[model samples]
Target: MRGKLRHGNVPLRGIAIVAILLVIAGAATASATLLFLGEQPSPPQLAAPPPIPAPGPEPDHALRDGQPGEVGLNPAPIAAAQGQLAAGTQPSPGHPHPSYAGEVSLLARDGVVVSRQATGFALRYADAQGPELPAEQQEKTQNDTIFDLASLTKLFTSIAVLQLADDGRVNLNAPVADYVPEFAASGKQKITVQELLTHTSGLQAKIELWRLPPPARLPAVLSATPQNPPGAVYRYSDLNMITLGVLVERMSGRPLDAVVHDRITAPLGMTDTGYRPPRDKLHRIAATEFETDPPRGLVRGEVQDENAWSLGGVAGHAGIFSTADDLAVLGQALLDGGTYRNQRILRPETVRAMLTNYNTAFPRNAHGLGFELDQPWYMAGLSGPHTAGHTGFTGTSLVIDPGSRSIVVLLTNAVHPSRTWGSIGPARLEIAQGMALALGPPGHDG
Candidate 1:
């Protein structure tokens, strides 16, 4: 909790973090230009930077496939993307990797899979000299291998709330206390569901609910004192989603996982995605941050988020693991304006509304109803006036570019061992940029 956004009156981190991201983005753009013109740009300079720490072992699979030379995309999408990307620039070693490494990925203009490759191992233990990967019996990570989608869980909760609103079952404008009466405790009666989705709630984040005893979780959550006036600023609190999970259970007459499965993942055909992964399926799950706090030792197959872990591995803000391929389905569902593979997860209008900016007053937060939008930082080359995505604290990122009709997913275990190890910023950018470099831009929808 001490590492929370230094200020409570506003959103997580700072507005300047956005600006700093923009500056780095500008440099990446410059690098793209140099590479476009046939000049190789220098690799990003890391000055004795602490190792790019990751949870579990280094993803031995990051670069195992789909490198530019190894994986070639269909010419049309690649040509368009190249032209659009080549604007006022020349081409260089475009689809390259940072020191942390990344998988080469490709998504179609229509969200169809055109290409994919896993160029690296999924575990350091698999390295020729390191030792042994997680388990030889475990399946090696392919481009389609499922990843534990960490915080992407919030998007599902947000969409569920929107679906309820569309059916007139819930009101975003109403206070949360309307359904969860005790939610009004601690002067939170004025907070609306919309505020929770947008993270404008005044809840002080992260009270180490997991560290506290079992019975204390509820009181600690209810006792989360406000750092500022309700709606005064934007502070991302895991408590917001936890409360939302509780609300879903109360409103839907079932557990939170049931609502998500019945309404979201199942309908979307995200077969490999969910909370409380099955015992038999553990071998396929990638290892994430190894825990020490609760002294759980190596964390594999379970949710990686601490707050989500505290809540029985199912919460609003975190606690969902998914694979890149499955997420592609979800991302395409949104890009299709709510329909995917003939199934509809949401109406087009609803999808658009979900992606609309609700945090104009809190530019630092720059969030859509539940989605973070146009963030150039972790968004990498996919960033633009219309790029939208969100990053999980556990080294995962998703960037969608409406302008290009593209989506890039980068799932990593940067927090594998501990939260330390500088940042995965470069890897995020390279992953998105790699996809951008491959796809170029779109012409028209068929």
Candidate 2:
């Protein structure tokens, strides 16, 4: 009875064993059912490492008038810079004439126009001989006064070429002869577009295109020979850009000036920037040198570069006239990676290529595709491997410091009365240093 104790006349021990078996079977069934229903327990999994984030795009800030403090800049140095510029307009000891006849300077940090100052007379001298114009007859320098861009025109030409490259219409590494077949003359068949852009085309510094008749000038550039082997040395040459202008015209089936206006200035809203500004805008134009050799007197409302003037004021090397404010917009656009107010003139990568130092083999002559880079002579405190700028013979400069996100533009008619007045190098350094100092130390917010 102890073993088989129940009412069914079966063994109690057997029943207990069956009950234990049933409980084991039920547990197994439940587990099987859970697994079949997709509720199976999973093995432990290690957590995944967080993903690395990509670098953010540069800020596309639009320019607006603001105080220096608004952009973490000290006002003292900037103010001092303004004083220096004002003093530059006055006669100094040793130098009988002012450093520049007139000037328009602009300093912008993070797209804010911290300082915009104008001083002196746009039309000061009667001629290149130092006779001052009668006071009432002279036009004072206004903030909007347009000055000849000189070599800064190279920057625009470069942008036009790069735009073609962006459009798959041109290859940088291709020979110049590919676009403008006439460029192949005089051992230039091997000269690459990149070499021309970087001034490493081994071309001579310049030719007297102005000496040739106007119709012969363009043809002369096409047949010009390189001074050295292609890519042998970095020689800043006007021929390189003149040839490039021809190439641009041929490839686009449009005049170089029209290409620049429709593509660059128009998109950037640079109302006062163009080659051969309209006759109506003459009153706002600054006067330049009085050329006796060319017999052009009081070169007002015209390009000052003899070669460009000879080219009908639309050459690639020097012709564009722009105000400090318009140029500031250009600097900001470049700083923001080639877009301003939603107008994308160049892709960010194209801009990167443009500002990249291609002439690394050349030491102090560091040059990008279309800009001079790390030029401490003019860049001063703002000089760095990434600092990009260009200086015009007409006493205009545009310095863009990526590290500081700042721009300093000093447009002066240093050659207004005469190119021999003095070197504007001191003024360039002062303005750049002022902006750099105002931004405080590197990496400092203020």
lDDT of 2 by residue, 1-446 (tens): 01111113222111221210000001112322222123333321111111111126757788999999999998987898789889889988787778998899999989999999999988888877898888899999999999988999999999999888887787776788988988899898988887898888888898888888778888888898788987668889999998889888989999999999999999999999999999999999999998887889879888989999898888889999999999999999998988999999997766766666666556667776788887766776677666799999999999998777889999998897888885788888778877877776655655
Model 2: weakest 10-residue lDDT segment is 19-28
Worst 10 residues of 1 by lDDT: 45-54
Q: Which RMSD values do the candidates have, in order?
A: 14.9, 24.9
Cα lDDT tens digits for candidate 1, 1-446: 01111122211111222332211121223422232122333432211111111223211111112323233433443434333322211112452222221232344444445544443333333321223346653334456544566777888888777777665566665778887888887788878877787788878776788888877886677656677776778788778877887888878888888888998889878888888889887766665545777877667778877767877888877878787777777777776666666777675555655665556555546666678865656664455434567877766777776655666776665454345532556556544544554543333222
Q: Judged by lDDT against the true structure, how good is candidate 2?
A: 0.80
Error of 2 at 64 (Å): 0.4
Candidate 2, 125: how far from true, in Å?
1.1
Q: How many pairs of residues collide in each model?
A: 41, 1
Highest lDDT scorer = 2
